[model samples]
Target chain A: MASDDSVSLRVTPLFSLCQELGARFTPFAGYRMALSFPAGTLREHQHTREAASLFDVSHMGQIVVSGPDRVALLESLTPASIRALPPGRLRYSMFTTPTGGVLDDLMIACRGDDLMVVVNAARREADLAHLREAARGHAADVALLEDQALLALQGPAAAAVLSALAAGVGDLPFLGMGPFALDGVLCWVSRSGYTGEDGFEISVKATHVEPLARRLLADPRVAPAGLAARDTLRLEAGLCLNGADLTPSITPVEAGLGWVVGRERRLDGQFPGSDVLFQQLAEGPAWCRVGLRLAGRAVARPGAPVLDPQGAEVGVVTSGGFSPTLNQPIAMARVPAALASPGQPLAVRVRDHQLDALVTALPFVPARTVGRACSGPSEPRNKP
Target chain B: MSKVYYTEDHEWIRVEDGKEGTVGITDFAQAQMGDVVFVELPPVGTVLTQGEQAAVVESVKAASELYAPVSGTVVAVNPDLPDAPGTVNEDPQGEGWFFRLALTQPNELADLMDQDAYEVFVAEAGESAG
Candidate 1:
């Protein structure tokens, strides 16, 4: 394990605010980010599901790609249909290696002449290098927004809180992005988030983030959450973390992210690793990502060996944790494609024991993202 | 009142009658772990050696090994933990006791730290971590 002293750590603009709110710091992507607040991870998870929560996500890499050939330049690096994306719409995509491996997964939002992209903090430098290399000889300029601070307000009550702060924010559709002002502070607001909740991600000047975060936290419904709750929230929502669920060696098809690849791109074989990805899509991947519902409370953390029915190691768990919402241990693992069915039986090696587990459908808890009407019952149907 | 002893790994054992002892993680340990979601305890009658892995405690963030502070045989394991593991975070020194052990060598307790020494050790550890 790498110690904090091994790397120089940076702090977000809201670092002092986090400290004032009783945040426990943890080293992440070379930044001293908040791991959890005094309310704890379990409570923070529950609070985010029930109410609104604010997160400082400034560590992520934010860049703007502009010029007449921006879409074409970006398309050469990613498999997404960048040319077809309309203004104010966000699309999740991945930068692929030549050999069908995922370089990094990112969210790209079209802003008329420019495209705004958000990449993982850990892979920011590499992603920028990759984009620069791909944009060579193209009429595109990639500008990193170093002075921006990104904050995400997430949960079922996010819209209500945001709309209260800004009148027109509630009008933005899911995955929609546009310029908005929060108390006269210019911000780029996106009605999207990683937690599968109805929320908005606001990008503003670093100088304005502290006040904005403080104002949002002043609301009774909005609590300050940290990286700990963020991870569990995404895991419960079946969302994959970049380094955990995705790696340079894992293709989009194997990671169950083939939906991000546009149909035309898949057929044209134009993007990097398109040949390998097309083959996997047509012939099926050797191993695929699946959700595991452990029989007991023991959690099968990342790197835990996933065993077949015969007690042979078949694959490895990429991410696992106790789902506070489900009140049980859930995990995401890459197992043999044939054994990735929803009801297949498997075992997860948790320490000295191989605990009983079953392959289940992703998203242990149903996502309550906005734009979808809450027509059904409010209570969850399946009990873990 | 029974005497309480602590280990370098932050486990605490309260010895009663010099034979039976109740063991659990220290309050400092639980605080550092953030939240306790699951705990795997040894079965009754399982023999444990001092400083060996005897149990597993997990939180949403990570999993940690719980080493036995003294050589003993597990006499009883906490039954309430499976349903309410948060007790470890709520009251780690009291209701959250992990298991009861029958000491095989009571003399081993002499090597452990008492409350005062354990407090000093924890202070030093916290300083280094900070």
Candidate 2:
């Protein structure tokens, strides 16, 4: 099943840094990303849990939309309420197809006059096209800033480690964005990350990426994390990966992202697939994504068949793995709406093995951020 | 001396004590897989059919299926190897042995390639990669 083609993609500026750390590099999203360091994936995963880990996510797209009509122009393309977002706040939004299917999920942060967007590295081209097409009739402008490198310094001690590199970072609340100086380099910093931990996503110029990464890694708490831990971490956090858990055919509503579509946007009914999403919201989706904890040690991997009490095929596992955090097998499945309820028992057949499983609330790990409580924007939360 | 045999799938088996056999992935196979992280061992006493996947080995690169070289009942599995998956890289033949099987038919070893032929196969694979 392996390909014979020898096609090496462009390496990031931190390629040598990863190698110096003895990172096991693997091809991902057209970039050679570290799968784990010399400590191995298990330790790398554990290290991130205990302290901090530096991730080179520079391959992710970082774009800026400026001009007077930036907020309005951006709101037309995404389902989130960008116009309502106060300056220095970030919102999770997804680009949708004409029919309202999600093209990609991204983070949009408002930086005063300009809007900073971070997108999945794999969907850079399609997301850019969607932005360009939406910008055609708008009053604002779009600029894809290829020069910015995205770096995620994540874990419990992440704030303490990053505070040393960048000043005034300690004051920034979760999901809040502001400009900061790292090594005298002015970069857009957002208090957000993929790992279900409190962290920061710093957008710096590509040239300054390596130096900042090194400075951050110099702290004893931070180890170089690769895609393997990243995947496991995100999965434990109950986050859905783009190609695996979502695609253009899956709408945001069906993907459990109805909250992103602001109340105003939902009422306006101008966004793509608004009618279908609204209807689905009124009457639950035919199939909803649910989390499953395998009854036994058997893993229910993606494409594995799900059976009912009578052994009839009911659904398929969209994403499944051994959750290092939970110390057991877990999975996400697109099952019939009736079985989507939490605490329901189900069976997953893997190679003639019918393993018992139970539906549970997503985010095997509860979000540790200061979010979920504050209905309002991230700002105005003063630190003690 | 215990005789060693190899399968085309890059697995090596060493028959010992007449009917008992120790199975492991070859060194060449481990090198091709890069860094080994997790080794899924078969349950002790589970009967495995020849050429069927009896266990799994997951490296940092990808997860691979380890085929049973000879049909037999699993007798013992190396429990230490899971916590120290790097044993597969450190000693692919000794401590990294996946499991021991009580062979149902010792004659199946005749179907596998001998050490010399296995070396030739590994050499050819290296040449193909080059």
lDDT of 1 by residue, B9-122 (tens): 999999999998999999888877889998989999999998889999998889988999999999999999878999999999999999999999999999999999999999
Candidate 2: residue A171 Cα off by (Å): 0.9
Model 1, A99-137: lDDT tens digits are 888889899999887999999999999999888887886
Worst 10 residues of 2 chain B by lDDT: B31-40
My TM-score estimates for the predictions, one after another, are 0.95, 0.87
lDDT of 2 by residue, B62-113 (tens): 5688999999999999999878888998899888999999999888889999
Residue A222's lDDT within candidate 1 is 96
- What residue pairs are clashing in model 1? none
Runs of candidate 2 with Cα error greater than 4 angstroms are A1-6, A371-384, B3-10, B17-19, B26-51, B58-62, B70-96, B102-130
Worst 10 residues of 1 chain A by lDDT: A375-384
lDDT against the true structure, each candidate: 0.88, 0.79
In model 2, which residue pairs have backbone atoms overlapping below 3 Å? A295-A356
